[model samples]
Target: MIRILFFILIVLALGAGFAWLADRPGELSLIWQGQRIEMSLMVAATLLASLISAILIVVWLVRVVWLSPHSISRYFRARKRDRGYQALSTGLIAAGAGDSALARKMTARTHGLLSADQEPLIHLLEAQTALIEGKYDDARKKFELMADDPETRELGLRGLYLEAKRLGANEAARQYAERAADKAPHLPWATLAALDYRSQTGQWDEAIRLLDQSRAAHVIDRKEADRKKAVLLTARAAEKLESDPKGARDDAQAALKLSETLVPAGLIAAKALFREDNLRKAASILEKLWKHEPHPEVARVYVRARSGDSAIDRLKRANKLEALKPNNVVSLATVAESALEARELQLARAKAEAAARIQPSEGIFLLLADIEEADTGDDGRIRHWMNQALKSPRDPAWTADGVTAPEWLPVSPVSGKLDAFEWKMPVAQIAGPVEDGNVDMADEAIRSLPPVAIAHHRDEPVQKPVEKVVETPVKATAPVKVEEIVEQPAVKTIAVPVPTESVIVPETVKTETKPAPAKTEEPVVEPFFGRPPDDPGVRNDSAKPLEKTTFRLF
Candidate 1:
């Protein structure tokens, strides 16, 4: 626009000058080379302007002709470069789409047209094509080539890491991930892989440092960073708790500052404080954790915070915990166990029953059995409760990846995941529900097994206990004393009706009378009950197996 306006201005100025010259005409006479030339001013001006314009035009034409070769060469080069880029783009798309043939074709075309130094995508396309074609060696070579280049180092490392994982080479994968993360902490995959490996190897300090790098690079959010840091600090605290109490306490306390409700952090902090003889601080921490989330470890540590304290004092502490978290199963169980330790059988039984009413589990039933043993010393009642416990649902424990741990762990042993352990029910058998009155699951379970011979000692007294025998669907803990299989002895045979399915339906299956194949000369094995486990003839495996052979008493 500016050029056009300037050109117009110049033209208008010349026209105005011409008009002025025409209005006030003058003569121009030049004496040169012994010759005299005369002309009007307007005509001389026109001829001079035309000669300068013609000279400029001739120069422009000569310059164009002189540079034609270079110009043509540059045009073709640019066109070839564009085609290479087009092929590179198409190859990348084809590789991602799993079109190995097109990807390979385009990769070759792009490689022919473009140098890998100038276009990094060419190597990437080739590597991807090799991977898609199941040529692992070629892909790995290409990835190595990429990794050697400074510009494509991260991409190459990612490819190498994936390939290592595919080949189940964890150490190689870890090295690649760590190398990539060290060079560029902002890369998400590299950072996460590096963190996981560091945690798995128990490199707590290094892991924390790497996590900080990730946080600083904004690869992880503030909330996630805080949580992960808390877990790491808690794990480190647990490691140092025994050897360096004060140091563990500091680390745990710091973790608590980040996540106040972390149970493991609070537990470690309290224990470490206790080890340091900071009873007041430890007790305070335990109370705070209990109020937030009731945990068994917290209760146990709090109840026995002072080693010098008597059982009654521990019971008092347990009472305080129960008061803080009213009606909770953990709190009630803690109180009951403490009371039992203090010899307060009544209180213990009452608390145990109350907890059972709230939520019956193996732990709760076992606590009840403990109370019974403490109170009456009755073998019958204790076994009854023990059987109930065995029949109860499984209790919750620290489980991760289908594996249970006796204590909390920072990472899963199975999957190497962070913060994986949880206090939840492990996968176990589901027992039958308990019945009211005289229907004891333990005795019933024993009776459900195959009949075992009960040989009596001379001094023993026997009594017949009537029971409707039925097979249990689940296996019993009762021991089946097996006699070695031998030659069949002559014995009477009785027809026993059994259902086609797992259940024994006496009324459904027709009972047919069959004649005895042999004479009743040999003694028959008759199933019996009504004797305590201490009976000389009854060799019971479970300490709590029901009367004699586990039959309900009539």
Candidate 2:
């Protein structure tokens, strides 16, 4: 728009100047050696203007003629360059689409049209074609060649890093990533790879520094940076705990400050404080952590902080911890354990049972077994609890990458990921009971066992005996089998031994009675010695009289 306006103004100025020249008429005469020439001033002015315009046009025509060959060459070159770029773009698209044949074809065409040095993208396309064709060695050579070029240096480094990773060359990958990060810290992949390499190699300080650089460069956000810093600091603290407690404590505390819910950091800091004989400080840290999320390690550390205290005193401390997170499994289990140690059987039983009811887990059932054993010396109740424990779901542990650990670790041993361990149940698949043809025999054996009462030590009402009657008719020629079955919900049947020719004991209700033929062998009654009836105790070779005793089921 401005150009058009300027042209219009110039034309208007020329027209006005011509009009002014015409209005003031003047005459001019030119004298030559042999002739005198005279003309009107307006006519001479117009002829001089026409002569200048013709000279300018001729000069422009000569300039164009002189530059024509160069212009033709440039035009062909530009057309070829455009075709090369188009081929390169199509090849890149084909490579992404996994069309190896098309990508290779386009790559060859692009390479034929454009010089390798003229287009940096041609090298990338060639490398991608090689990669698609599984020509890794050729790809590596191209990328290495690109690394020498200033413009493609970062791209080359990234390619090299990925190839190194694919080849499992850890050192080479780390070198490439570090170089890339140093050159361009703003690159997210390079920075993150460099950070991971440092972290995996136990270079905690370097990892933390790299994380800070990434954050400053805006490669990572503030929240992610803070989380990574906490993990690294916690790992460093764990490493220095035994060697330098003071430094470890400082790092752990710093990590905890950054992320309060960090279990490993809290544990490490509390342990460091404990090592320094700062028990109160350690307890304070653990208590603060327990309020957020009750961790078993924190409770253990808290208990350890007061190691010299009596069981009752420890129980009080455990109660204080439990009060912070009342419904937490860790809190309940810890309190139950402390109560058991303090001889507070009722409280222990209540807490353990509550935990089991809330989340039926192996740990809770085991705790209940401990309570039962401490409260009552009855083997029946303890065995019952133990059986429940065998069927209960497993408790949560520090799990990372499908590996579970008894203690928490900041980094995964398998993947070397920060904050990889989680407080959750391990993956488990419960198999159903095997279906075999011998199920009936097993059922029959289970039905033969006598009921053993599960004794409760608490001051609750005793459970009434549950009697189930099963009738079996006897033929004189065929032997009669009387099997006793004990049934419990969600529990497998227990069997009592019965003789093949045993007589059935009648229940209180009236039933048809069948007289049994006299048997030559006396009946034997199996004794309940807390062993399965099928387990033969000892063989007596010497002949002895078979003792007969009346068996009754109530």
Candidate 3:
């Protein structure tokens, strides 16, 4: 638009000049050596414009003729290159679509038209075709070629890493992952692969350094970095505790600073401090850890922090921890164990039973059995609790990645994952759903148990508690006939055993049977579902009160 407007303005200016010249005409004259030429100013300007236009046209024609060969060759080359690119695109599509035949065909065609040097991705297409055809050797070779080139180094490393992982060559995979991560830490697969290998190999310091690098590169967030670092520090501390307690303590303290609720870190730190004879610091660390997340190990370590403390002193310390985290099953169990060690059987029984009521498990039941044996030496009661322990769900242990460890660990044994162990019931230990109301029922059943009159040493006589007069429940329907109520004399029959045969013995009844019609109903007798009346196995109740009868051992 500007060009057109400027052209219009120039034409107008020329017309105005011509008009001005027409009004005062003048001729421009040119003189050569042998000839003279003359023309008007307007005529000379018109001729000059015509000559410049003709010159431009002639120069355009000459340049076109001169470059025609090169232009033709360039046009054909562009067409060939376009066809190769089209084939490459089709081959990539087919590879993604899993059409190995078409991909290979296009790959060959592309190779015919273009070399790997001309298009780097042709090598990738060949690799894809080889992979789809199950020619892993060829694919690996192609990847190696790509890896040797600077342009496709990261791509080649990624391919090599994945292929190595697939082939189960963990060392080669780690090498490739480290190479990729060293070049670009932003790659998640590379960073994770390198970190996993480092952790699995127990290179704690290097693993920590790698984590720092990854955090700085923003490949991993701050929270994840701190968590991984804490695990690494804890593992390192555990390894160093025996050799260098000072260094181990520092590492564990750092780990605790990173994650306050990490129980293993707290335990390690406390143990290191114990080795250093820093009893106060060790106890303080354990107590803090217990408050955050109460663990039985923490309680045990805390109670036994002092080297030469008596069982009584340990029991007191256990109680203090229980005060910090009261009513917890772990705390209660720890205290019960310490009390048992101190020979305080009653205290142990109370705490253990309380813990069982809260969360009944094999460990608590076993502890109860131990208390029973210690307190009264009651074999029946002890066997009852021992059987219960065998039947009850197993207690919580340090489980990680489906493998249960006897103790806490910073990393999983199965997957090498950090911070994996948890203090919870193992999956295999779960029986089924347990009613929460069972605790109340169990308490009632235990209370109803008759006190055992165990004999003491030196032939001391044991005193038994007074028996109560208990009423037996009667479940029956009354007769519909409206007859006068009459009491029928009925004798309770008890089965008596004999060496040869069994017989029924009559016993006196204190509680009256429910009233029925005067003459239609038979005398009410206790129903017995035993062997035939003459069976030798039949035993008599001997008219003993329910309280005096040792009915069930458990």
lDDT of 1: 0.79
TM-score for candidate 2, residues paired by index: 0.74
Local error of candidate 1 at residue 376 (angstroms): 4.7
RMSD (Cα, Å) for all candidates, in order, is 14.6, 12.0, 12.9
Arrange candidates by lDDT, descending: 1, 3, 2
**Candidate 3, position 169, lDDT:** 90
- What's the distance in Å from true for residue 470, model 1? 39
Stretches off by above 4 angstroms in model 3 are: 1-65, 183-186, 428-554
| Per-residue C-alpha lDDT of model 2 across residues 1-554, encoded as one tens digit per residue | 99999999988987897888899998788989978888888788789889998999999999999999999999999999999889889999999888999998998899888888888988898899899889999999999988889999999999999999999898999999999999899999998888888888889989998899899888998988898899999989989999999999999999988888888898899888888888888888888888887777778778757568999888988999888888776888899999999999889987876666555667777787778777764444566666666766677788999999978776788876667889987866353122332233223322443233334554454543333444453433543343433221112222233455554434332121111223549643433334346433434557464443333232
Candidate 1: tens digits of C-alpha lDDT, residues 341-376: 998988998888777766677888788777766665
Per-residue lDDT of candidate 3, residues 350-430 (tens digit): 898888777777898889888777777644466667766766778878988888999877768887666788888886543
TM-scores of all candidate predictions against the true structure? 0.68, 0.74, 0.69
- Give the least accurate 10-residue stretch of model 3, judged by summed lDDT: 479-488
Model 2 residue 522 lDDT score: 62
Shift of residue 523 alpha carbon in model 3, Å: 24
Runs of candidate 1 with Cα error greater than 4 angstroms are: 1-65, 376-393, 428-554
